[model samples]
Target: MLTSIEVAGTAQVPATDVGFLLYKHPDRVQQFATSQGGATVFFPAASPELCRVVLHVDGVGAKVDRAEGMGRYVNVVPFAASSRLVVVLGKVFGDALAGRCATRPELVDNRWPMTLTVPSVPTGGRCSPAELFEPLGWTVQTSAQPLEPPQWGDSEFVTISLSGVHTVRDALRHLSVCLPVLAGAKHYFVDDAEVDKLQRLGDGWLDTHPRRDDIAAGYVKHVRSLTDEAVMRLAGDVTTAQPADDANAVPERRASLARHRREWVVESLARAGARSVLDAGCGEGRLLAELVTALPGAQIAGVDVAPAMVDRARERLQRWRGTSVWQSSLMYTDPRCRGFDAVVLMEVIEHIEFDRLPTAMSSVFDEMAPRTVVITTPNHDHNEAYGLAGQWRHPDHRFEFTRADFAQWCASVAEEYRYRVTIDGVGEPVEGLGAPTQCAVFTRDDSSPQLNSSEGGRR
Candidate 1:
């Protein structure tokens, strides 16, 4: 940690949450990364005589982009072993960032300015308090909101940024770097004037409160509340699609209604912090598109062995970006894709060959690695639930697991996957509601907060 620094030494910047004196130590970074259960991060470092920043990672090499005078983002694929973030920034030869750390710590924010025209705000990660009002100290408190996918082919992007500082100016400066991300919201710092504005807002807001430093926290809460309200309001307008025309459109109509229902359903789940989604034999791209819409910027994806379903998913999600979709059998290998924030395994889990249920589900969990996997199937115990009898059978359902049977199956897998499990079904029992639809929701002990806090949505 010491060898990489320039002779002048680094100035310390105090942070309420993530405070550390940053200095050039490219060499020590490799060691630090290894100590953190992370793979070594190797990237080119700027000349020691000029600027200083440290970089480390879990991969052989990362693509490093320089930050303002110093700092850089070492972009790499996520590590499956752990979620810890590894970053490196510094000057590169013949490029900028070749200087000592700024002496004027006053560049920090104190102002409390609001963004004038933030277009297409990314979900979960709009802007960290630091990036939103750079030059003004700031802080952030985020809550996830579920969304829906319109088309499988649509490209959707969501970013959840954070600012863990005490002043408004600092938050704004941080925001400047992250908001309006399409314009390259990579990195930012606050100047003195902006910092002053933030401090004033903090002082003025707290002037009305018993505690002075409480201003930033209160303001962040208020703003987050408003944001959530706005999202919920938008949700009220979306509903199940009405009946369609053409007899051939029957299947299409059912698909359409399901799509609409998916949006609200996913949103409701996200509000409660559900994780992981499984399209249980997601047919075509219908539910997949809806899942994308419902969970903006989620780490969610879809899988179907049918060539048609895979193609349809790709098409349906062309525009709604971020989450990736794939074509693969639920019965198969390569354990990296299993657990997730949540799983949607909707209608497909019931039909597989009976013996395959345990193995298939285990594979799904192992591949997706989600905290929770949401399951839905008809209530075989309640014939009136769906108006069916023991004699009746759907051509598609090979075998239906009773609530008890399903619970046991899930329990076995939970044990195998090292997760604590819980079960719940979709919809409630109404006096005249037709069939008893059953759903099960599960969560692993290790998954709760980590999945919930991830700045992405799942519905």
Candidate 2:
């Protein structure tokens, strides 16, 4: 299997910097030994205008095992990019895939005009090339080859070329997770740890992708339990909480766990005597709608990073005058978010990458400085109720906190910001399992001095 990445450069910005981002010097040709064969990485064209890095793997096909009856007769590994290719490439570009750059850290987050070429890819007759790649912003082109014209219709493999603007890290991670999904096979054992690998590489994009379920199923080789858990984790709803005691419980009054969580936030906001509220990461305005009804006279606003979500929220809340929804990221400070009596980041913080979590927290607590701050995240302690023990509820979640862990984090933040905090559960508890959602309410201490927006809060 052969795959390559070519980066185009402009007069001002040269493609040579890609070396720093990838930590691969263009002057050197590196080779590594693999179980099936050998893999080599080299730059065929290295210049300021353009640079192309090629990864060539040889002898993998002969070692790959075909079906039981077919034996050594036919193997598609050589002609197709499979999990084996992912393994080789992953080993070669581990640091790049993780967005780590010691020399040029800023370049790791930058998107560049680049083209990715995979000579042969087998779609396993399940999905089209466009279906798998187009949704991720890649413009795809495919060419089919024939084995022997009349005798054999057409080869199952296709040569695919993908062009797009993407960060080197994202591109590497995408290929790492997508190749196995596309080929519909894995050379290694499919186990619980595979889910973590998928999540780690597929972060930021996979959870929101349109073909997430299909990708998860194929990546894990369609293990039913693993597939179910993965799909639920990507959807952020791993479990539908059922009554603890079916025989003794009333079915008529039961509601969704999400609704319960929203209700809890609304109640907490009301109890805090909030006259104005800001809903950070207000996805589709679900909680915003409830907030409007629960607090009629309150000045309420919603902000989200996705423009599509903001547009949806605008339409959802358009009927409610005086309420505004706009697109904004929580990672940076926004003057518009100031002067709110309360701010609710329901199920938001966990979505942030752990490295960036500090910046986001400082933006909300130190920059916005609302009188009351309410936050909620998935409680991993309740994963057993969802049959997801030792696994995260959502693939996009950077980390889910157990009750003790959540309390410790809350206490640290409260102490640093001088806020009185309280912890509670959103969903009904299941004895030792606790609630599926954990909530933390942070109220500014009475004695702590308050800074106005002009002062830029407490910094």
Candidate 3:
């Protein structure tokens, strides 16, 4: 097959090397990707369907350079409408320890099965797997994978280290405080130290010696430093007070701990007077069940990109046969889905790419014209109020927001899409963590000036 590779003028590879090399071996690769200068190479894929792609790194720092710059370094990740396998090859300069290269799940730990180094980028350069995973409902820290280690020492520890430095507890605390602060949220911090022991248990163990031993302590510390503290603090405060009891009370194997968060959404839906709703990106239809109960006559639909998630949601909503779920991309310009009386996107927006937010949100709030839309994104300013450094953050969230950021974005939407926006919080603020959440209620009036108009354009 014919291929082109970019290489430094000073190096072994050249940008304009023209050739179709004959290859007989099954494993022989026809294409190479590199940067001619700092990162001088681009290998166009034969098709978007090809299962795997490759990128190379020349030295030690280059590995970090590539890993830290994954989104900027290699090709954009392919999103699936169905479960399709795709391989990403980070063929490191053969001698480099594979440990330096990390994929999402690998980064949090210090050990791994040692695949060849491929400079894969973590989420959006804003956060890590450790930071985004928990909030979005994956169990990287408290759960298991084949390579999962009891401590931080046993995975691709480099990824976790990139976040910042702090002990596990300190990192989580810092994350709670900082995440909200960065979002311009208010009332985020409150000290749980003075509270009863149960809340402290989740926050205290990181300081224990036996607990801290045998892990990627340094990496753990760094991961803590990178989160939006304000969001964590505020959320923690609310969650503690309300105490997501359903999740904590469930059987361990179902892994339904997110039940508490889902229940909260159900309550919010009732208060909002939602008759019919779309649980965009609903995980297991946990919220849908409550909606079905509360509004028996209401129409409910669940949509998710992950088919497995859709399956779970469908199973949960089976009795309410009116509830339909399809595995479809929510990123389309005209999502082709009907707008409901209400749209609930709880704990899901943080997992999406920010660049695509305007388009996706517009599709729901404008083009489809839902009367009421409720969204909850972590409040960044809340993290700062606690003055804690190092904390809890989810690796999947593209960006969390502060109250001002949320309001500003909502205001912009109102100005652009003709929606009346209101802001509310799920729980009270910590002394300084900021509001745990900045829940925005968007109400649109169709007869108003359209979003694309000059006076309301997204400037």
Q: Can you give the TM-score per candidate against the true fold?
A: 0.38, 0.51, 0.44
Cα lDDT of candidate 3 equals 0.44
Q: lDDT tens digits, residues 1-459, model 2?
A: 799999987776688888887678899998878754688888999999899999888855335544311456665565468787887777778789888998779888878899999977877735577887899999999988667765887776778898999999988887887777777777664545677678778889999988888888888877665687778778876545568777565324235568888999999999999999999999999999999999989999999999989999999999899999888987888999999999999999888987898898899889999999999988888776655578666646678888777777787788778887878887656677677788888999855532221110111
Q: Between prediction 1 and prediction 2, which has the larger lDDT?
A: 2
Better of 2 and 3 by TM-score: 2
Highest TM-score scorer: 2
- What do the candidate models score in CA lDDT, each in turn? 0.41, 0.80, 0.44
* Superior candidate under lDDT, 2 versus 3: 2
Q: Report the lDDT tens digits of candidate 1 across residue range 1-459.
A: 111111111234322111112332344434333322333322233332323332333434433223211344433222211111211222111011121224433423322122222212332333333343333333333333234453444222322333332332323222322332222222221112222233333332323323222223222222332223222323332234446664444221112223334653476458647544555466676776766666666655777778777788788778776656676677887444555566676667767888787677767667666666666665465443332346223545678765566556666766777676555444433343322445555565664222121101111
What are the C-alpha RMSDs, in order, of all predicted structures? 22.1, 18.8, 17.2
**Model with the higher TM-score, candidate 1 or 2:** 2
Using lDDT as the measure, the top candidate is: 2
Per-residue lDDT for 351 in model 2?
A: 89
